[model samples]
Target: MPHIIYNINASPTSDAGVYPIILSGANGANYRFEYEAANLIINKAPLSGIINNCNRIYGEYNPSFSMSFTGLKNNELSPIWTKQPRFITYADKYSSVGVYPVSVSDYDAKNYTIDTIEDGTRTITPRKLVLKVNDSDRLYYQDNPTFTYTSTGFVNGDDISVLNKTPEFSTDATIYSNVGMYAVEIFGAEARNYDISYIPGNLIVNKRVLKVVADNKTRRYMTDNPVLTYTIAGFINNETENILLKRPIAQTNATILSDCGEYIIKILGAEAENYDFEYITGLLTITKIDQVIQWKQTFENIHIGDQIELLATADSGLPIEYIISGNVEEYKSGDRTYIDCLGCGEVSIRATQEGSVNYNPAMRVVKYFTISEDASIDNINSDDYSLNIYTKDGYVVNGSLSQQYIEVYDVSGNCKYHGTDKKIHVGKGIVIVRVNGRSYKLVCK
Candidate 1:
């Protein structure tokens, strides 16, 4: 059987296993066979072009082979997720912001860059994206950036019409303040109060400040002191008192003399406080005595001895009361007769006594003797005199006169004694005796 029983193991197609062989007839070249390649021989299959080129499943080319597939897939599918639209950059650049999303149009795609974002089409940097609330761009890395709102009349939800501008009360406003606000009170359409919180920040400064001032006025100037005099207007008695005396005349109720020199009047000037001025209209004094007494004898045409009672009364001057005894002697001058004083206190003679028609003794001077009875003369005082005697112009009674005589008589008309006076003392009553055979009856005390 010449090995009609075929040894299939030896045949090149009998074993489906990996084999190494040499092609002897082809110049001894080396060849290798994979199990799948030997199976393709056992199945009598033709070689595919993939296997015909090279099969590098488990060699250094395997990793490099899968990488090519990945590069091709990336190049083809990249446009699906990576394409962008046009967007705006910040017209003015900002410093510290980074990239962020922004709105855009698809037509603006050429404006995009790598490190920016886009809403749907256009790309934008975060520094260029302006926030609606503040109109400030976003900083790339800033957590929160500074901003300002440009809306009119909008604040932090407070009812303040005036904003960052200065507040004015009226046209002519008055602001009452010290250096700064410790407290404040205001009244307008409403009453408002504030604490130190009225100041917001330290952004502004006051270079110059204001100040205040005051004014005043007054009145007082029209009265002080003057001078005056005093006098009396009326007096109690007119004839004997002085009135209208000078100021400070006397104390109240004091005695004073009137102008007419009559009766006394009381004073009324010293008790006044101010100056007492005077206007005296007329005489306010008692110038006359109230009453008079009359005595007359030897004035009849028939009766030898006539007598009438006379009462003592006050008159202008002094008058005496006495009993008319006898006349010592009598003389006629003009139409009047004068009799010397006899032993009585007085003697009376008239113009019609013993057939006398006219007698005027106004120019006659008489000398007579004086007499005395039992009366002592020293008992009379100075106030009791009937006449105030003064010597006639250039004639005076000095020392004593000699040749004087005296007579003594009784009440019955009988002569008691007559003698030349020797040492007839003064202040003694004496009786009269005349010389030349014309003795007169006179007495003096």
Candidate 2:
């Protein structure tokens, strides 16, 4: 962990000083802080800084220090003197916790069973059962075993049905006489005979079984979910398992009607999953023999809503995720097909584009106006005025502005203002103005 030292030098903001310096890694034990000045002795000795002068000195007050704030034995050391205009040290504690490795064991309860074996009427010796932990991480931990002849009807190699299955053994049909002192062996060292209780969630650990061995060298960790894992049959490339998508017959590439002719409809690599190759007829064939082929029934000319079967070889089993489209000679429509979306819970048929698209480009209209000079707040006596609005299509709409004030200004230091209350026609383009008393025209947009 890095020990960051925020050294607040006694000098003001004008002087050059290093404020915060981070000291980290294994070499941080030998890190030292130094304060030096030009044309003076550089302090290289490692010692904690001590305030000697009031604030400044004539020569140089260079002091180097090792981090030893914990051993502040001076009772007179003021807390305020150590804080203000002084360097401080702090080490992050969160990065110091040590991490250790742990392992877990798993078991299959269905595989093994338990049985009993007896000798005489008065049993001289009880056939004892025991469990062992062979991990070497525990020093002096021996391979201790326990008897499984307990009250829970436990037998040797019996599935651990209950906690009383420990020391689960019986002699001459007699149940456990003393239960507290006895220890029973519930699970064994076999990979499929033990269960580890460390994992959380629905414990379905299926990749590997729990084992008790002298060496815990295998890289198996405690997992939450467990499932039955098996291999797929007859697969060559490491038995590659994939998700296949089966859907209705659809087009992959759009049918482009560039010119009118007998065009053979070819199936793209993606569209072959929708149709069965062997069952389809009057369409292109996709087989191991020939991957792609022309349509059997050739269209004299391409048209919309034309059906074509796409066959894919079994080698390429899964269908590619895409829709097929084509352009017809009759209409130059976009790359979209109308279909019913059932998942929306409503009958929705719409044309959707396949790839990237650009929307329609449009132009914006900016009106520029010209104002007359004589029109102002001091001059307008009549209420009649004319307004003209025009469009890019060469259409003009006109209106009159009456009984309202018309104010205008130009870049050449000219002003025209008026009041008129009439219908005004505002249009998109260069605008012209007319005033009753003004003679000069002012361009004001």
Candidate 3:
């Protein structure tokens, strides 16, 4: 048999298992022996203890806090002794007026766990003071003005002293005398318990002064009457007393005899109290009267037995008078007048109106006619009387007649030529000839 010896070293992390001790024979056969070791058990360390759980402090100033922890031993499972507690906060200092929650935590580096967590709160508040004052005030010039104010958040029986030196008016004396807007201030007050706030207000002072304003106008001569109007400021209207200024005097009167041109009417001697005088120059003009004349109608192409009254008009508003001459007779029926055509001849009519104060005399001439049977009569073809008329180049007629008077008329019944000669010259058109009570139609073309 062979003898064997074995030595084993074990640590805390050593594994628990069986070991073998072997002895070998020189020929072939071998023997083995085994030994077992017990398993090692380690206990966990205790958790750290929290000394301070919660706290509170003022936020207006910087706050200081300390977190103390116990039950931590110098071992592998214990908390880190060199590490300090960390604080989770939104800002470094709480200057604003509000409440804040702070968290305090301790970390263990060896055990990888949180030891303790603490919570705390901080609050900041403003000093209480309430101020009240009037927003605005109005007063007349040379009148006394005053103001008052009130406050809150003060201790009982404690008087509140305002820092405002002058509460009535502005520092400048001219501000009250002038008519304008101004600002008045109500200063803040500093007290032991609370601070009073500052406020601003407005002051309005009015002055009594008059201002006159007028508008310039234009007028027509002998047609429009001139009227003066004005606007006065800073004055009141009353029925019991007259507050208006006197009517202004005219230096030059408006007259119809002025020439047709632009003229000035100077205004003077206007007075009022507490007001300044102002006047605007006015204009007057004279113009000539317009003359209008019209002829309503003229009677033309009139035949025999045709009656008509000549019509005419004038702006002077007067009745028209007529005078008839030539181969017509004037006759009146009722209030109307007319001219009567008796024979185949032209008649001259004249319409006239007398001059008036505003219009000149007007006249018009009307020439009318009467038709004869010779206008439609065909050319006479007799041995005793032969008439032939042509109007191609010019009016020409070759005729033989034993008559003392001869007359030729166009197709429109207008007499073209009248004489006692056998040959006649007239314009180019169809014509009729009357000779010795005979009628003949002559085509002068």
Residue-by-residue lDDT tens digits, candidate 2, 1-445: 5544343333331222234333322235676554343232222112232322211111122232211122122231322132223232221111111221211122111111112111111111111223432211111111223222222222333444533323222121112121112222234222122232211111111111111111111111121112212222322223122411331222222122122122223222221111112211122222111112111222222211222222211221222122322221112114322221101111111122221111111121121112222311212223333432222232122233434244332212223233452333332222223333222121222
TM-score, candidate 1, is 0.15
TM-score of 3: 0.25
- Better model by lDDT, 2 or 3? 3
Name the runs in model 1 displaced over 4 angstroms: 1-286, 289-291, 296-317, 320-445
Among all windows of 10 consecutive residues in model 3, the one with the lowest summed lDDT is: 162-171
Candidate rank order under TM-score: 3, 1, 2
Between prediction 2 and prediction 3, the one with superior TM-score is 3
Models ranked on lDDT: 3, 1, 2
Residue 175's lDDT within candidate 3 is: 26
Candidate 3 residue lDDT tens string, 1-445: 5454444444443333343333333232563544444433333344544433333332234457545445444433335444666776664333334556667665444332444454665444445665655544443345536655566554434445522332322323232344455666565355433445655555555545444444344544345545645454454332111643564565445465443456665655665442334555555554445444577575657654345665566665566677666655566666667654445655666677665543456655454444442333234455544444333444444455443466665545566678866557765544656554444555554
Model 3 clashing residue pairs (backbone): 378-441, 390-444, 391-444, 391-445
What's the distance in Å from true for residue 182, model 3?
A: 2.3
RMSD of each: 34.5, 46.4, 18.0
